[model samples]
Target: MDTPQNTALTRALTELPGPLPARGVIHIVIPHTDRFTVVGNHLAQHAGLSTVAVGLAVRIQSLPQGTEIGIKALAARFPEGEKLIAAALRELEAHGYLRRAVTNLPNGRIVTRTVFCNQPTALLRPRVVAQRPAPPQTSPPAQDPAPEPPAPEAAAAPQAPALPDVQQEQEPEAPAPLEQEPEAPAPAPQDHAPFVARVPPPTAPRQPPPPLPQPRELTAELDRAATALLSDLRRHARQLVLSENDIRQLAPAVAAWLERDTHPDTIRHTLTNDLPQPLRHPAKLLKHRLTVLLPPPLPGADDLAAPARPRIAVTPFQTCDGCERAFRAPTPGHCRDCRNAHAHGPAQAAA
Candidate 1:
């Protein structure tokens, strides 16, 4: 049933490097000489990790040191939503592939440091060593003795005293004069005041607050509202007039605030209230407010409660055809009063 072309194709496929397997994952891998990531089978095929977590782990490992991998940064970089990415991060943490430490900096700022472990088991095991016997102690090498000094000259030596005549009587030498001892001066008056040491109180270590909840993705309607709100900030506060580029740059941050059920009025009040005097760099100030004061997402309804109903859209305003009165209706038509008059007029004429 095989033709000449098919036979050649099959032969070519068999000749290729890393022969194809009968089932599951055929790899025709080329050895990478430069940029590539090395992942262990335990991680790549981990039963505990979801596909997103595994891929995220590998990508994180390949990145250079000091790169930002925060929830916000990762959410912006990848197509995955923040909630899913957050869940994936939790999974990686549970598996011992990632660890996050919160530390209070000396400058009173709290920072989070993330550490990734390539070999989790190796981190837990204690190291072993083979002790070798100490080398035998040895004395230092000795140096040659210096030559002896030349003998002292005879002139430097003093002659011995002549002996006194044995027969002559020796008078007792006058007693040497007794020396007087010097007297000690009286001690200076001492102050009786008690000394008190002033020691400063010990400063308490600052504890980092609980982590803020991750923000949700903004919907299309919410994005438009956020952009409009930012563009209109100038009307509320003269100092907050922002350029097109600045608005575009800051729109996402504003959208994050709106995504959390915060009202437009509240946001406007927050940004415009108590602005600094001589405010320079309006864009930067607004950006700081948007980030530092972001509110948490609204809580979901209880499981036992019924789902909230969808909101009905308001009808568009239209002028009635019969009567020139503006009214709320989906389509142009006669107003209620006009319709009633017309209907009754025809019936009353017949009566």
Candidate 2:
């Protein structure tokens, strides 16, 4: 009968045709000791260990000492994947199937060594040994020194300057000219009459400004109308509430309808007609109806109710981050539904 090491080597040899390669061949033996048997049996006892962990442990135990195992390598070999393989490694270590030790070198470098055990055991802490001083070197034997070179001489200084001669040559003087009469001042511009011979006719009197719109008019009552619309919407679906900002947003849509010469009542009727049983956002629904469902004007009526032309430079309202459902808010934040959900979360939790 072959020993465990020989048995493993023979099994490995079976994979090759006839002869084993001289290099790159690793010999690993599955120990047949009682400790190894106990460890194999104990693997099944770890309820927390997943199938991936068990597979990793078995693979690690089958490898020769100092064999490299990397995440990408393991991922390529096993179907469990790198993430699961990494998680499994942690689980294996936590359950004592693996022990890792980090050693620090005298050069301030750190090296990590992991030991996989067929049987689980406590980890061995790293021990750092003090570095010893190197031996002193002997002095070299005395020898004759080389001769020194001579220094160069300094340059001589210059002599003092002599005194200058008096009376230098001068240029000839120019002759004076006779005086002449003084020049006269220029005359001022003559006074001129206005461009027009006669004054223009008196202008027509300015007309008084048109009277301000009354409460009945949609323009003046836009805010109140928006509020009223919200109240009516709540009656159909009770979850809707428009903030002041929300109400202000609806004014432009209502104003568009008014500009189309659409009666306030007709606009409201068209909006509330055929409403859904459950409405998530009343403001969004109102905006869509006002902008899209708005009726064309009657014969000989103005088309001012048409949507404002879209411009690339002019950005529309921001979409809600929570649902991306509505553009009623000015900034990218959670919508009312998300806000309500957050507000009622505590109450729901208590129940």
Candidate 3:
């Protein structure tokens, strides 16, 4: 059926040239209803519908009925944004191509509904009509049940048999047996007075519990390590400043390093190495270093008590070029294992 909208769109489309020469190698189909064509073509010459507005209008006109056609939805599908879409909608309304009615539903909620039309009209604004609820349906009166037929008469009853006559009995029922009167129960004995409990003598008062041992104070060794770490940090970064709170926070991380048997020199080197040119956050830097580079724990006393074994000195050992493992070597070269593997290639099979 050609609605007013379809009629307007068809008239508008028919005015355009039949078919253009192939403009591009890839052509996409423009899917739209008859009404869409009418509305879109009518807006083609519209001064208010700029390039952006026209695009927004086309997107809105092509959407399926009941699909959300809001500024955000339009902006997502088309490059034109909420502002352009809003302007185009207003223009369409002014030109009689679109109508938006503010309606109050039966629930008393007010909402604006937009209606798109291809044909321009001078009709008045749409109004909200309060829906009148339908009247309750009355069930048809139940039909009276049909009358039942009368029942047949019942059969006649039989006559009862008669008993034989007996001689006069002189023996009387033992003089009407006399009913005996029951005697009231004797009164219960009165309860005896409650016995009094004997009281005991008072006992000695409780003594205070022995005083708990005082917690051990911070060790001198831990204090020294924390002080040394702070001093080294300040010396390395002259611009860095340490507050009392910062020192208090850094104490724990330093104590953790000490407990792990980390040497003071090693701790200083780890914390001072690779520091940013301008140290902005000293506490944070120290915290990261202490946590990330924490040394392993010390060996137990039993390990130290055992006999010592011969080991290569640090000066004689160097890292292997290929494997990066530390070993005693006279000069720079690959480790023996890596050398042997490299020599035995796939071409040199076992003989």
- Number of the predicted model whose TM-score against the real structure is largest: 1
lDDT of 2 by residue, 30-115 (tens): 45755342336568566888977887887877666677776777788767778888898889889887767898989999987787
In model 1, what is the error at residue 204, expressed in angstroms?
Answer: 64
lDDT of 1 by residue, 1-351 (tens): 355566766666677875355456544455899999889998999998999999999988998899898888989988988998899899999999999999999999999999988768556555544345555576997988997775577556887777687556799999999977755655544333334456767798887643322336767887688789998999999999999999877777777777777899999998898887658789878877887788877777685589889999999998878879998888888888888999999999999
- Clashing residue pairs found in predicted model 2: none
The Cα RMSD of model 1 versus the native structure comes to 34.3
Q: Is candidate 1 or candidate 2 better by lDDT?
A: 1
Point out where model 1 deviates above 4 Å.
Answer: 1-19, 129-351
TM-score of 3: 0.24
For model 3, the local distance difference test gives 0.67
Residues 49-153 of candidate 3 have per-residue lDDT tens digits of 566656556666677787766667766876766887888777766767677889989999998787876545323434344455555576998999998765453
Question: Deviation in angstroms for 114 in model 2?
Answer: 1.2
Q: Indicate the residue-level lDDT of 23 in model 1.
A: 51
Per-prediction TM-score to the true structure, in the order listed: 0.35, 0.23, 0.24
Better of 2 and 3 by lDDT: 3
Look at candidate 2 and tell me the lDDT of residue 262.
71
Candidate 2, residue 231: CA error in Å?
84
| Of 2 and 3, the candidate ranking higher by TM-score | 3
Cand. 1 Cα-lDDT: 0.81
